[model samples]
Target: MRSDVRDRIERAVDLMSTRMADEDAPPSLDELAGAAAFSKFHFHRVFRIVTGETCAQALARLRLARGTNALQRRERSVTDAAFLAGYGSSQSFAKALKMQTGKTASELRNEPHILARLVERLAHVEMAGGEAGPRLLAIEIARFDPFEIVAVRTEALYPDVAGTFSALASALGGTQGVTAIIGRAHDDLEGGVDGRPVFDCGFRLRAGDAAVPAGAEAMTVAGGEHLRARHIGSYRALPGTVDIIYRMILGRSDLILADRPTVFHYVDDPGETAEASLRTDIHVPICRIASPKEKESK
Candidate 1:
């Protein structure tokens, strides 16, 4: 990354935070793109790469945050929150509240604890489409601790990881943290997979001595350098988010894509948590830049 890339992105996020805090709506994508001095063509990709959210996600988060706060305020009626949330009516707002928070609007109003997690998650609950979606992305390079994972590899018959993950879970029912779903995809699937794609679907072992689940294989992952970001709320948008990150990395001069596969860490259980409150972290392996030949490749 250029020295100015991070600095400029940080400035853009500061601007976004300020706008979200205002009583009025924020600037459009075009506006933020101009401010960032990043090309409009790559703005969304760059923003999502650095922030792990689309412009739409950012807008929805702010709208929901403001509305949820209104719900908690004694003076603010559900109607007030609805309008504050950019919803046309309380009915719509309430529907969104339940979908996003898994609680009625009344429940959130009466309980403060629930709101805290929502804020922490930065989840979005949009009733309808299209806010110019001028995107909080704090994209960072971080190291994950070394760990061992017991996972099921996708078979010829089972190309998708869904069934593989399920079988692993059933086999590991006795294991702790088996409910947490995590995966690694070796292929980008950019050009399309060769007969079957490569995916290792399962849980990271918490104990070193823990036996690998009957049907799974154990491997040690070094978990070194990776581009990391948090995506709170819903896996529905995950595919697009990952694409955006890939585009940004491909277009960048500083990024050196590592040989290893990308890791998807599913932070929350959608079955147990609301769709809007689901948490997912994407870890894109990155190579450390050093040699002049490597730097000169750009």
Candidate 2:
């Protein structure tokens, strides 16, 4: 496949995943096509060819998978789960569950062992290997001290970083003592793409450098431990990298997501380096494991 075509499909997949994860109603075919910048007919044909599933089928699978997770985690009642999963009623949700997994929602909810088995099954289904599987070069635990930065924010999607960064660079105007270039994603993609998500493109500032440009603001990145993964590729492939990280976290009981946004540290300048050789360190904030007693109480 052509690189441009692959990037378009990836963006479509990301949009689909976002909507499904948010438990929102599936988007219309036109919406998906528009997101990919393709005509509706061509987009449908290419999406099926690339993903091996039609748009509707992919959405259904994701909804059922997330519904299973919710049942296993005890996060919502059956009726509530049905609504969130885009099913009209508990009866319809149960029927779909049985068709997909050969088990009813009540059975999975009432039986701890069965729920565990279902969780394991759903994990494999969710992270099934694909052509654009994650290519993370390394993973590490790192600590960052609080640091200030001046950023220009925008409500754009991935692969559109150049414009946002350019705006920030123009704002800085040869300011001295820059530490690093960073991209911060402020929205949870898993929750549906409703309005545009916010992205902050900026440079880390030196200590005591309090000069803030007009139309820009200074903010502090909190100090804490984070799970960092190094991704070596084009910015277009970052979604695949993030998917892998989420799968890793799901497989481990010791890690829980923190309430902070994910950060990307660009280690190489794109203008000087080829896209294939670019490196980005993605940091996801995480919390330590909970005790078994604490788990039981919850």
Best by lDDT: 2
Minimum summed lDDT over a 10-residue window in model 1 is located at 126-135
How many pairs of residues collide in each model?
A: 1, 0
Q: Model 1: per-residue lDDT, tens digit, 1-298?
A: 3445545556666666567657566766556766776644345444555555556566667777778877667888999888988889999988877887789877776677877666555533221222212222856888887677788776332224556766776787743665356777654322111223356787876654457767689866668888887777656566556665555564466665665667888887555799888778888777665668866886
TM-score of each: 0.48, 0.54
What is the number of residue pairs that collide in model 1? 1
Q: How close is candidate 2 to the true structure, as a TM-score?
A: 0.54
Model 1 CA lDDT for position 124: 35
**Model 2: colliding residue pairs:** none
